[model samples]
Target chain A: MPEIMVFAATGRTTEQKRGLARDLTDAMVKNFGVPAESVTVQIIESPRDSKAKGGILFCDR
Target chain B: MPEIMVFAATGRTTEQKRGLARDLTDAMVKNFGVPAESVTVQIIESPRDSKAKGGILFCDR
Candidate 1:
């Protein structure tokens, strides 16, 4: 089972999420030689306050 | 760099999210011998309708 997890900041539209899932599933299927139905793509989003980069919270950036 | 992504249904409180991030970071640091600062934990939550299992949407389950 090939599972793809994407971590990103919140704010994407439903359509964007759907497109990403589809694209990622297609990539896995083509590169990994796996069935599309067997691939799972999960998008994980965090609010700015909950995520940090370079020792600074994203909300503070 | 070791990044941890968690995908789950939405509903956790801020405190729970904070605890999970801390615990997961600690786990990576301990197990992988990586510095705590080197660990990144991101939680992605989806509504029940956005997630599915066994060919059925979670909202319907």
Candidate 2:
């Protein structure tokens, strides 16, 4: 069983993430053939300043 | 337009990821009130030995 962990760290709210996970789970079950319980989507919320690579934030621009 | 980029870097095939994206997009549209074209899922595949923390790979076990 492959646990699908979605690390959503940007551009969305927690409620949105939950909704997304629900939808994704349903889709995976119905179409992608992944089991309902196997899908685990996690949303790690990042502040507006959190995204950075070498001190440059893509979302800030 | 919001893009749903799914960075799947472990334990899945490319075709499986694509299928997931398609299914996720459809489910988002049908149940979660998101536009179909606004969803963009990207799968970044990683080698089994690529997962590391302080130079130790977890998938090697």
- The TM-score obtained by model 1 is 0.57
| Candidate 2 accuracy as lDDT | 0.59
Evaluate model 2 with DockQ and give the value.
0.23
All candidates: DockQ: 0.17, 0.23
- Model 2 residue A18 distance off true place after TM-score fit, in angstroms: 3.3
- For model 1, the superposed segments whose C-alpha errors exceed 4 Å read A1-6, A10-45, A49-61
Candidate 1 per-residue C-alpha lDDT over A1-61 given as tens digits, one digit per residue, 9 for 90 to 100? 8989788878899999989999999999989999999999887678865654333345555
TM per prediction: 0.57, 0.51
Cα RMSD for candidates in order: 6.1, 6.3
Range of the 10 consecutive residues with the lowest summed lDDT in candidate 2 chain B: B1-10
**CAPRI tier of model 1:** incorrect
| C-alpha lDDT of residue A21 in model 2 | 77
lDDT, candidate 2, B1-61, per-residue tens: 2345443336765677667778867755664465687555665556667655447675755
lDDT of 2 at B25: 73
